[model samples]
Target chain A: MSLRLVRIDDRLIHGQVVAGWLRALGARRIVIVDDATARDEFLRDVLTLAAPSDVPVEVLNIADGAIRCIELAASPEPVFVLARSPRTVLGLRQAGVPIEVVDLGGMGSGPGRKRLHKTISISPDELAELRELERLGTRVEIQIVADDRPIPFRSLDSTH
Target chain B: MGFGQAALIALGYYLANSPWLFGLAYYTLFRPLVAGLLVGLILGHPAEGTLIGAAINVPYLGFISAGGSYPSDVAFAGWVGTTIALAGGLNPAAAIAVAIPLGLLGTLVFYGRMSVSAVFAHWADDRAEKADINGVAFMNVVPGQILLFVISFVPVFLLALNGPGFVKDAIDRLPLWFSDGLVIAGGILPAIGIALTMRFIFRGSAIPYFFIGFILFTFSGGSMSLVVIAAIGVALAYLHLTFTGGLAPKSTEAAAEIATAPVLMTSDETAPAGRHLTRGDVLRSWITWSFFSHANYNYERLQGTGFAHAMTPIIRKLYTTPDEIRAALKRHLVFFNTEPNFGNVIHGAVIALEEQRANGAPIDDDAINSVKSGLMGPISGIGDTLSQSTIAPILLALGIGIAGGTATGSSIPNFAPGSTGNVLGPIIYVALVSVIIVGIGYVAWMQGYLRGRAFVTDLLRSGTIDRVLTGAGVLGNLVLGALAAKVVTLYLAPTVSIYGAQLNIQASVLDPIFPGVLALGLVLITFWLLRRVSPLWILAGMLTFSIIAAFPFFGPGPQNPNDYSYQACTSSLLHKYAPCGVPPAPSAAPQASPSPAASTAP
Candidate 1:
């Protein structure tokens, strides 16, 4: 029933995460959920190697991941499930995946996104997804980098 | 990769897909597999087509770069080489030898496509300001891809399907003069590329060190490897920093800037700016704190260290003031760029310097400029070592592995597990990308927000970053050494078994220091001939040398220059797959010559 921290990073297994994040979290597994990821065999193999071998990684798609939420409830291993978009989380919740919280990570700022923090930003669609996650009982937060604290997404929702 | 094949592919692709766009000879689209398959299916060897196609893709693994620069034209080469290898009754090596010109034809294709791609970029440009993001993105990605496919698909198909045994007949009848001319010309063309590389990185503080690394490693004689040269590199990098690094006053400017910025991060901040991580910050962005992933982030507008400044929100929320952010930014500032490798902070640090100024960080104008000033030397060093010294050689090594030892494919002495080898293939990319992305990411985040004046001052206290580079250099040297022995220049060609004719090739202008020191003589000759010589001259020299060597007047070996061909010598397994505009390749392996490269451990 525990997911260490929910992050949305495209490059799931990289040096910064392995050397910096893993060191900070004292985590055991990195769970990735992305529909596109499932289709890229080479990417999957490469990502698996990027992360720490000692700390296992399970790259799953949103549907399969949500269905396997029961596995999370069954197993005690601390995990971090990374999704590409907030909607994926909403889909997970609707699919019966029980998640307690979600933290925002690096999202490359582009159209539809209003800058929330220097490293943090979001779009209207994303804001709605956050609201959807919160409605599903998952606390939504606005955190982009590792050296920061939790700020409720709702606090800045109106201005942004 | 002969000239005819490239022309055929370009013509075919354009005609087949878009008559408006000549896909002929464009490297990205030059699909040798399609060509080979088309040829084999027609020439009684679908298996051969598939075999050649698979083989041609090898050198391509490491083929990508920031720019579209590539060395092979697998499309034509694949079609023709496979066809020739099959119908000409030649082995793969000979087929490859015959295909070199075809691959070379793609070079012209590149020049042509660059001009066309510029139009597409301009087209994308018009859409970008209009806020047509997807349109712009598509323009950037799709046009080039479509163009490539067209150019590759048609020409390869036509040449393979229609081109005849002319090349084979040429092999038999093309007089020694023409044949010898090709061999000579082919050997010299690379000088143009080398000169381009050298011109960019030949100067600055790190130049002498490059020489030291080059000479010492080359001098050591045993399988000169990166491990060896990198040892000297470690010493060179460390000494350069220790003796000359801290002297710059930019640190003070950086300190002032750090003192100005604030680390007022939001709660969800999880960027990796290495300022002291607060417990709350750790708890909040725990997922990233333990790094379990990666991202290919491009702050298109945030050039330089603006990326580092992007972490401003996180830093501000995590810390009370700019001190922590400053510290983090200072640690990240360096003359880093990913052309050589990623994870380099030089660009990020410079961006931070810019942001500090923009945010009124009070860095002395002169002090602020130091970051930029400090970059040229380091950048130059990295460019030369990574791109010219290491990378070029590795390309050649991969070329050797894929092309195999025999000039003739059938005569290949060894395929020597390249990509599948622990180092030559995918691992090279993984190692390179991991190093690059994390390095760049950290620098970007730091420059974004973590830096302040005090923070900048303390971070560069001469002990921390210096120690890191020195230690890393040492480790790099060790690792590069093992790689040199095992991965880079480890191949040994079968020595010439000559009769009792006194060839006199080994003249000791300065008496042979070691027994049969002809290898040393050869190295000196190549160096002298190459030293400050223009590439054209170098080409001329090589042609002259190859011609002299190929003269039946001189020897019985296949003397025709056109005799050497290749399908995709560059597409060997020794390269990494592309993650960005370029594929991931660690520093290149030095060129394999009878003379050692500078891979002798320091």
Candidate 2:
């Protein structure tokens, strides 16, 4: 039950997953790491309802999610980890979970963010944390859906 | 027929390019129904134009152009389809049959343009790396327009000038069985669209909502307006959200509480925040991006070059050093795509972040890119569903129904084909859609800037979007149900005589239970088949079935214009309650001959 893929998508469980990503990843379990979604029963119900019936979905806060990810590291079953922000993925990685790759799926345009890609908008703080994660040997890639080729994380050649 | 009409057709094609240049929605300008009305007005036959447009548009109701993939060119179909239909003096149904083949051929132009656009994107990339902002903007706009003009103007000018005679000749030569197959095929094509929509909206819990819409419209005798259905749907969705406690703890309170919430494993780094961008700067970027996001769309980066082009104004404002500007430009020049209207908020937020980075925040390329990558998928998923799938369909159906009017009589004045009210249908649709898109886009962009990162988080937590989606789902399902009942035309022609009593299968069996039961069943079956079989296969099957069935009373040719109505047995095969092969005389109705004399002998 090792973490198969860690994805960052603010909308959480929606069509890109149920229709596009699930088939692409062929994963049977989804663990959503978000404090707000985990505590809110209504959100949890909605998320579960939104996902396909066959994919067992569980929503947990960062702490429990990290523990779950660590526990699943030993199992043969592949587990998909999802969170709303890069911070959560960083949190899971810092918690000693061996996440090999982090996939950034969606982040909406908001104030104080820049458009890096069509579906992604990020704040400076979020960007810093992602760079730190990349430096820590966790490869970060941005892909819109399952079918798309993942673009490797690239940074400005600051030496110039 | 004349230079002016040809010019108008060419103009419609040119306007279709506005999605890239003027930032006007692609849906508004190119949709066959809407384009038809515009073309009709130019030709001094708005009513005829609309009738033709509506007929041509029906087959493409479920059309989607996600990620710049043009499966069939609706714009080409609408402009050329209406032109050919009107010029050839063909009935709208027959015109639809004519237009489909043309639309498929238009895909060649689409791919040609897409392939050409990539060269420009590469040129823009070279300019961007050199920090030539003006050059990048020029590449985004100029070459694309030149290419657009050549593709749209040449074909339409020639087609409108010389092709009408050819169209008439071709249509005349087509066998009745084949022509009839086209009409039947057109009537049943909406099922494919409805099924595709069902695939998008279907979830286990949401299934019941679909039925509610279906049952309500079925029981209403097909008289209920979509507006009223939408209003009721909104209320039901609200209740569902509130009763389920989906919107709880209030988003503001949640945002405030969650700020202090503990992360068990992650280290927290507190970066000092400072104001950098003015509202004017952010708005400037939005305007630049909205109009030119896909101006230089290419196979290599999609919207990547446009992304860099949009950030030019902000990049200039913040970074004075050439290296800084170069870094900023390179950062944004990456692959990106999303539902443009609802997804612009991400742009707004990123502008704010860039401002902070200029003011000494530790933001680098990866952070900005990472955020964009994360949001693109989910926002696009939601945005595509909201804008393209749900809202557009509802608005179009309303417009089509209004323009079409009631089956038995004309409630609105006949401006041309049916009534002056038909014009109002498209008018109301364009206005309503324009207002909602602009209003929502402005709000999302501003909110992203004002609230910063917390804005999106708050939006999801507020449950407004979820509630709105649920409501829209309810409304969409009901409207589709109503549309299926009223628009999709499929019926049984067989009659059963038991105990000396003649009972019509459609009238006595299906009509009493619900209007359009056969149409609805066909739609559902198509939906099921869509899951298992490819769309191409289903389309082929529908064409085959329609043609084969033409051997009976339902033989392919022009169906009575009146036959496209919701009344089960009146218009189609049962010409006047007696099925087509059966003479009005009950004595002759018992004959074994199923073929109507009008059917072309196979």
Candidate 3:
């Protein structure tokens, strides 16, 4: 895909995306892959309204997201891919979508999750999936925003 | 008057740039509603200033600056609009008309300033490479603020000092019919603002809430205060959520439980943590974020430069080696953007992480970045809804109501322009906003610092935010409805004399049907237009309609200062419950007075 960056952020699009990352990356469009949000008409509308007027947004389920990514692989404009969890990205990779680098942006704190970065709180199950993706040769790195140098996921301690 | 107004304009300059010193909440002091009141105080007409500011603020209710792109400048419109209106003796409506154009023009300066600030950001980037900490800090605040000061101060200063005279002289020269028509236009124009806010607050199911407010005010004879209505709205919303159960999603309850599951220092519990940074350092960084978070906002790395600047004190305190210092600066200089006040928790969590990393914690730079990246969006969503959409509009509406009381059918005139009511509106608004926000913000920052990322996540995921938003929406609807009933005045004075019975059309026919019925209809019509047509079109159409409608032939003329002609014309339109308050002795010289202003209350 012509995806310049693939980020895992629960909040698929927000101030950091519109005001920070989009400008820093200079991406033309954002493709948010979250099944629940894609089906929710209300949420989809809210996301579009929240987005900056210039940049277009596409909300799609995993299957559609994979197809769109494949189509965008040859498109002229670079696309920024985002999902709420690592498993979603892993699914795309398993489905024959080429994702070399996955930027870990934000995974919110909750039960059964250990705090990794100030922004990332991950469950053991999710961590195993990410590790599996790393073993499969995806350069999964923890880079919250564009300015920071991406730290290799291998460097982080997987143990809770 | 000239010197005082010039000084107030200088204050406006300081208020606009004061984010670096006073914190971002101080930015509200520059908003038109509040600024107008301050200008009024300076010009010996605080009430008039507040009334004018509130009116001017209506058109800009939905104004937002997403990603440093602005549609208009509220500070310029509010300060200059209030000053010109009060000084020139124009009503609130005419002042809004004048202020809107000025606000649109102010956008040029905003864009110009954003472009110039990029130059300053580049200079900071150079200093970052050299590890010149002090130089980087200066690049962030000094040059950028100077540009902001000049742009904000000069136009407002010149306009406030000189524009009044021109406005007064121009109005004096205009034909009486045209000036009277302006007053009519001013009265009708507030509908546009009321309608605009409706568009923002209205959604599925929420639509009925608006009409409930309208019906309540109409049936109650429009005497209730906004606070009382708000209380009623809150109770009703709570009951609706409790009984209906379907309106608010059920997941919110489960989310709330998970959110408040208690503070877990999961990974940090095992890490060897010691006090490396002092309380003073943490507070310093917090203050810095408060002031300079958006100071160097640009197209690239939105708050990147400002974030680096905020971290300087902490970085200097922690790192001794040049490499460490340079790395820390570059690390912070990454992309950062969030809602300023509520978003301070992220800064707090970062400060705690920095302290641990400095004290031999295995935490690498990526951990810190992830924490910020993760928390920024969720925190920002809560912050934007709470601060911008809910708090601002609710408070502004209450302030406007206090200033502009419900006096449509009263014998006494609608609260005079510079009266006590008008002055109190802005003062109360400033007080409430500062106390509630500043108090909550301070506690949250400290909590985030001590508790780290877990605290903010818990806070964001808590269902309290959703419930609060729902309640606020209900309150906003009720208040908007109350405001329509109180402020958006429209009536027809056409009377029919059948068989010499001399029937009053509005009082006899319309009052029996509903009070504020025409105003409510006008607001709904404007709301429909606002949805389909551009605001500029609605504005132009209203101006044309009001002026044409104000012609003497269209209805009864106002109480003419020179003759008894208006009294004779309107005598048939007088209501049975009240005597026409026209003075028995008609004076020789003309004075300005409109008999029962049909389209506008003030």
Candidate 4:
């Protein structure tokens, strides 16, 4: 089974993903599970390029994502999973998927926001949602690029 | 409503109800580069996708998305940067350099609650389990990106990559007038996105200022620059906020007045519409002392940092429901360009929609965020295309040309943003951006109200785009008429002798039509004449005019204004070499050993 980091970062395949996560874990592939990115021939090519040449990229939105997931899990390839937002992460958690930790890397703040860090922001609901995730014991930590120690999302309010 | 819908509902339930996969999608799928490339491939050219990916990757190159409130336009930069770079033979470095401001234009596409994207993801997951093939495909496929990264990229990319030579050749061959018209047309086309955004954002108080700006500028004959006018706009916006707008009667502050709202007396709480806002409430929303910072204004679409601006007020309202609050928050969190008050109307409409939903109206966030997503992609495309790439460069080009003594320069060459009629270009640019921003605001706000939360989502759907395009086409045609009549300038004749029985046969044949009018007519006639001409005509018209008139008239011969006569500018350098004997010869200091005077004297 691959040691895959399925993460929700909304700014998908960014420097944090490629330079931060993939470089650290020695991940060899990135499998994207989002219908829009998968079936989109344009997005497929984009994700393929985003994956390091040494590693491979497989983009399959949910339905088709299953096949790749099943395949990668059977294979020994290391992988990273990515999406562009938090709810994508939430969706996976609800599927009862076995994941050891949830890494909150980066999602740039915009309108109606409260800054969580230099790179993260949350509406009150987002704060509450992460709090709920912590209750579920999902380790939610915010990091931009990997080197810096992650800030736990559980303590986001005061911590930020 | 068979398997697809059922599966979608299941996935929506599971994912909305789930957490892990939501994490998966956020991190993996919506990557800027991945999304860019995917968009390119879907559009048909992976290379174009990569190119766009790289362009978007440039400005945000050193960026770190620390807080969730990133006000950069990396995605949009990639999308429109790729669109422009791929559309023509623009230098990649130049394209990247130019795309920075354009990237910034995307800052307005706020996601009040990015989590809303996750809701749709869950919706998809549920439908997937139900074996709703079409639903799975659609929910998975559309993020308002079906057309951009999906269809257009490939064709444009192929054209850009392996085909500039063909395009160059095609331009070389197109009819002269037709090409100029497209150039003229292109110059004005970007205004649409601004127009729509602005319509929503411009409050009644802001209207007189728009006219003030217009008259002050036009009366200045396009001298009041955009920066100056924008300063005026900003000052006016602030002044209105401070003086006339502040200190409205706080009727709602009284508990009794608020209690008058038909409160849902049931177990928990939910307020009805008519009962929600009292006259005081109506007056209160518009009242504010500060212009931008205090949260009255949205900071607009291309500004990229107003989520906080809009959110502060709503969060403070406190009486708004969590769902309503969440929806309100989510509405502002959409990926949008920050063009300021003009773009804020989208914020207002979205908030209104959420308010409706909270009032037990039919709208919900899932549908709303989809609209936000849909707008982010295209508005980014249009915004960058208009506000940044097209507007900025075209203004710069026009300014430089106007400054460099060539009002005859094509509208498509360059761009910039500013405020002043001293250089009419920048003021025009600001006006155009202002107009577009307001127009977009109106579109977003009204659409939100009319279509409900599902507006963005419906936009993400495959077929609804025709409705938008049809509307744009109609508007585009109207704009074309405007361009033909007003924007395109046409006048540059080489010579006009007293009798005007010109030695130049071409001049004699064209005695009735002056150079300017001829160019303008040609522009109108070309667009009118050629069934559907594209952008190449710009090159052709420039080439023809540059050779036959501009070069022959202005280049070798000295160009002077009508009432002015030419005088040879004395050459400071040539004085040393001034032929044999000229009177005021050498300087008192020291002559170059043998000056023309000394040599002639000796």
Candidate 5:
């Protein structure tokens, strides 16, 4: 219950999440679960700096993130989780993290990525991973901000 | 209403959206408060225009349009909605009711413009392929601006020319209950804006500052102006920073780590002395970026075309062969977007990398592109929070406070007709915003060039940005609290039948406890609801609640029944429903008045 929000946004620890979501959800901690970011020392420093100094930030690989998230879920302090892609979330879920809802906040358009919703573009591999996440009994919704309506991932036409 | 006036207003709209003003117009003229003044001046009612614009701007106080997605198009609302209001002779509150819907419709126009501008990005891509630098620049500014002019001007011109007549006719025919509902909606709508701002700045530890501001304003019995409150806020912010040790440097370890990090160079790569770029070339590049970063903003590539256009001076200076020029242009022309002011650091670093590459360094396209894509997100995160969330909102709240006569030393008065409190509000806002934006943009740009790729790391680790953000958060919360007290108008209309005596909740109970407890409560409730409900729904709910509550013995009477401007507004629009010309009897209940429309209906 302490895991307040699990979001997939490529631009992790950015303005929308910090200024908009963190306060909205009253989450005190941010857990960035991305292998690439966890491996890169400079990116870790940059992301740590990007967040407010009061809130603690943890940049962990998938395996470590899953363990940390489980511990956080059992704790009283609220935690906000952010990942770069669906694959990361899928990794966490397979690692036995009880995730009930997955919010697709932002995934920028790039090479080989197809538009799925407003400002959210994902590759075929990502789309499949999201479908897998849904099949694993997690609700996937696309919501950019707290004020926006959450659109279910299943409702969007995935043909393109 | 004249063709000439309408055309002038439309041209102003075009210029606001266009890239010709070095991005100053977007921050100034595009705001409804300023746009209203401009439109009113065109139509010979500058004071009324400023008031209406300020009213329309109330609900957009926390507005933030990040990454090409706008919640509402206030610019469109400013120009078209103000024109319609002025032409129709609607009061400030009613004008807000009309302006809110117009702002929603403007999002469609924004998306349309963004979608179509993608074609121009493709055109620029072709020009880059052929190494046609002029073609690339032309595509960035010319076609995109033309499309903007057409989209922004044509609709505004037509709307301005004909909308007032239609609105006047429609108002003349509107039913009494609906017109009453519009006024009530206007009074209630400002909460949404305040709540939206609270979503961002109202966080842990900063929460107390909000209450401090609210208590100061509410308990001061209307004696303290927003300026006084803001002064107190600044002092408190400084004290808070001092006690929290936020001003102390805590990132020396990170800075040292970055300082000593080894540069990754291939073992076989030779270090060649590259042709050094003059500071003037970098300055020119930065100037182009500051002015035209979003000149050809499109959905496909976002700021990609604008990026290539900015790099033209850099490319022209660094490359000689056609292939080299083509490669440089094509690389910069990929998808890019960030907050234009603080995001300049990325551009500066890219320029340094380009210079190094042209000098035969081992860097390739992937290295430069990775740097851009990687830093853009984090930089934009900090940049947007600082500029959009903190700086813009605080300044805007100050401007709004001054314009609405709540921040000045004078007593807060109802917005009387043709009474512009201070003309200096908008001017001060524009001047301050321009200086900050241009100053920060230039400094960040130059620092990026001078410091190269390590600049962002250094800037973050120095703890200066954190201190600024922390201070801004404190100031922002305090000001927003004061602003909510000043702007959000909510009165509990229903009186409780206590011991067979009428007890007005707002006057008898609430005011004794806290002067604006109702308004503060409404803002907090709306802020809480924003987490679970969409803003559009909250807007609809408020509109519905206002209408139903305005019924007899239900909601409070007209917001400012005794105010002269409210009389002027009601008399002009609701003359057929009730006698607005004659003042209401002081002892009689507002609902006790006989309605001419009700009598004639049967």
Candidate 6:
């Protein structure tokens, strides 16, 4: 019936989200929106196996995911939406998925990426996408677990 | 106390934090319980050291390090905290207060090590490019371990050398109320660890079982031990499983349906049977992974360099030419991180692909890399939940219970001095964890190698893992509830004046309704607060609350007038505020005997 959370984590469906967030948010289902994962059959199977038997997981590309999110909003079940990158979340929002707030769970360090918070790294491109999402009226917050204090994206030192 | 002992403990700490000995150090020696026993042995006061260590370990029972985020450094708390407590002759409660700040400071050391070791990962990448296999392996262990040793040893050594005298002086200068507050804060701090773990494992349908464990222990009037409670819990879990369709034939039918469902086939299905890797090759690779998986753990590539090091044996066995070897090494040198034990399946499947590729299969670089990346996240999800949240915590609860003397019988007021628990506690814990890690790691690795990619689907379709997790949930909640009752200490120091007679709120009001009701309430409130606030804030609040509550009228005092002595009161913070009429002779022997009766004071 409602989307409980929309999150961005590089390591999707890992311990924190499954054990910590799902129960904390009371979401019964998971819908991972990512183009690469949606196209990869092996990844899909692994993810499905990774989830608890009771909670169903749906992997969809951005275009299909946007449509699915609208339908999920109409349903009675609570859903938790996950994506790997800010770009994916931006695409979903632009495609008309009514996202008001975005929770950044994790983004590991890699090439061309600068540290944004604890264990969260963002590239210039991803930073621009997050900025664009914020401009569209979505509040962005960085929180690793449900219990941790959520740090506003805007509050972080962005001069670097 | 001496230079030799200090240096020896520092060396022990270095080895415990190092990646050698198949990573067993992190599981065993790194625990404060064991660290206490080890430090105790070195200091010739093994029992006293262990008691202090066990007390400090109580707050870290829920410790979990996932995705390279460590909430607190237990190793620092265990090694350095235990040493200081022993040398300063501080009791367990005050020692916990000291240990906590050190644990927070130790996080700086952890982050520093993680960030700086990234340079070694970059160094390994260069060696892989040059086909320098030895160089790559060297970079993984040599430089990273040197950094770890320096960071781990020097600080611990310095702290052990000078920390005790400094802490003793500080405590000597503290006002009576403030010292009492530190003890009160120590009693309340364990609630945060329990609450944090509750966030992860406590959920709908399993919530009631926690209260069941708590009530069972509390109402038993200290007659029930943890082992007895655990037995009842296991039986209850079995019954719950049977009635909840966990053992029903319909679930098996559903599992069968999933097994027969149409599933996509990967490259393993069309294997062109070229060169096959021997069992020895896979075993060697797994051993390498088990021992050195986090040897070069860093921010840039988390476990990338370690992954390449693990694959060297397989790559060597499969590839002969320099170009082939270089390509194979470089293929696995990309970003990868997962739960090392349960994530061994990825390693096994990749080994199969590499073996097939060497024999002339059509598998490309993308196929192998995709398998690693795709499976890492999902495997880590299940693995971290099972290993970190479920297995480790359950085992730790038992170990802590035993070491703190709460498991044998509930008569002990959790970690009371002069009641140093049996040393067998740490030994049993180490043995059990070693068996599980080695056994599970070997089986998961071999299963993945033998069944290839299909193993994951088969493992999930069997329905056994679900049952195990379900059973673990019930058991984990029960033990945690029992642990909360046994470990969390919250005694109300305030008294209410009713009808011209003073009434102790803790005894007359709370205990008559339910024993440890305040402790239970504190844990639940903390659990609720964890949802909206960080643990650090909760800790700060508890400390401030305790300190402010330690005013002359509000603070706790000795329960019995006879049990109080000025020397005993001054030495042990528990009885410091007891109203002794007159100071005893200076030579009055200290009453170091057990004061279990003090908890029931009027």
The lowest-lDDT stretch of 10 consecutive residues in candidate 4 chain B is: B593-602
lDDT (Cα, tens digit) per residue for candidate 3, span B1-602? 56866777656745764564456434366567777778777876666677778777766665545434455677778888777777777666567767877887777667677667767876887787888899888887888778877877777778878887777677666554455555556556778778867755665456778778877766776667666777788787777667656233223223544445454232445445544666788788877877777676654455768888888988998887888888888788766667777777778788878877877778899788866765565467557656765677677777777666334322221322322245677777777777767665677778878887556545443445556666677778887787777666565656667787656665677767876677788899998776456677787787777666656654445542222234334422221122245343322112332111211212
Q: Chain B TM per candidate, please?
A: 0.46, 0.84, 0.84, 0.31, 0.89, 0.89
- CA deviation > 4 Å runs, candidate 5: A1-6, A66-78, A90-98, A135-139, B215-224, B247-255, B261-273, B405-421, B496-501, B553-602
TM-score of each: 0.40, 0.74, 0.73, 0.31, 0.88, 0.89
- How accurate locally is residue A88 in candidate 3, as Cα lDDT from 0 to 100? 91
Model 5 residue pairs with clashes? B493-B556
The clash number for model 3 is: 5
Off by over 4 Å in 1: A1-160, B1-104, B156-166, B175-520, B554-602
Candidate 1: tens digits of C-alpha lDDT, residues B6-66: 4553454333222222111222123443444445445444544434443443223223222
Whole-model alpha-carbon lDDT for candidate 5: 0.75
| Descending-DockQ candidate ranking | 6, 5, 2, 3, 4, 1
Best by lDDT: 6
Query: 4 or 6: which has the higher DockQ?
Result: 6
- Tens-place lDDT per residue, model 6, A78-101, is 789999999999998888777767
Give the per-residue lDDT of model 3 (tens digit) for A1-160.
3455689977677645654466556686888887877775434544544444346778889999998887886676777888989989888878767777888876654446766754566888888889888877788888765535677877785444
Question: How do the residues B311-374 of candidate 4 rate in per-residue lDDT, one tens digit apiece?
Answer: 3343334334444444344344343432222223334444454444545666565655544443
Error of 4 at B515 (Å): 25
Listed per model, the TM-scores of chain A against the true chain A are 0.87, 0.93, 0.93, 0.80, 0.94, 0.95
Q: Give me the runs in candidate 3 sitting further than 4 Å from their true place.
A: A1-12, A15-31, A34-64, A67-160, B24-27, B204-207, B234-275, B359-367, B370-378, B409-420, B493-508, B551-602
Candidate 6 similarity to native, TM-score: 0.89
Clashing pairs in 6: A1-A75, A1-A76, A1-A77
Interface RMSD of each candidate, angstroms, one decimal: 19.5, 8.2, 11.6, 18.3, 2.3, 3.6
RMSD to truth, every model: 23.9, 9.5, 11.6, 23.9, 5.4, 4.8
Name the 10 consecutive residues with the lowest summed lDDT in model 5 chain B: B593-602
The number of the candidate with the highest TM-score is 6
Off by over 4 Å in 2: A1-160, B20-22, B202-209, B215-220, B239-276, B408-421, B500-502, B552-602
